[model samples]
Target: MFKKISWKWYVGAIIFTVSLALIFPLVGLKSYVNEVAIISESLMIVFSYKLMIKRLSGPVTFFLGLLVGLFWGVALFSLVGVIYNIN
Candidate 1:
């Protein structure tokens, strides 16, 4: 699955994985498998946000876009975690 994925998807996944590890650092849940799972989930959010962005057709679009941005932030963090091996 990683073979055909986009750079952004990979990036976003890693960010989230690291965030979770840092938050629960004492537990030290960092692992390759853990990172992969987090990355996978984060990518889904990013893709969802991308689809939602198209629905931005009016005043609420701005607000919705903002919300999507926040979602992207989260996905980015997960991607970071994967990159740093923080799971």
Candidate 2:
């Protein structure tokens, strides 16, 4: 189902999500930054799951996608925390 989605769409989504992660701090909502990261990461994982399910047609692939999403989520969360601290 997601086969028609272009790479640009994925890039744009990532940019939008990251921008949101950064914006919370800029607007003095620093406390909510972690929440935003978690929410965004969850969304990413969901998307990854759906995409993998549609393309790979197997439970194992779904698990792999979940793992990848988790890894990315943690990395993104750490990155946002670091940037927030740096500022």
- TM-scores of all predicted structures: 0.32, 0.69
For 1-87, candidate 1 gives per-residue lDDT tens digits of 433566576566656654564555445544444454545455554554455555656456545655655665565556555656553
lDDT of 2 by residue, 1-87 (tens): 555676566657767777888888888888877777776676676667666775686787768777877887888877877887834
Angstrom error of the Cα, residue 73, model 2: value is 1.4
In model 1, how large is the Cα lDDT of residue 1?
A: 44
Please list the C-alpha lDDT of all candidates, in the order they appear. Answer: 0.54, 0.73
Clashing pairs in model 2? none
Error of 1 at 61 (Å): 0.7
Indicate the residue-level lDDT of 42 in model 2.
Answer: 64
lDDT for 77 (candidate 2): 77
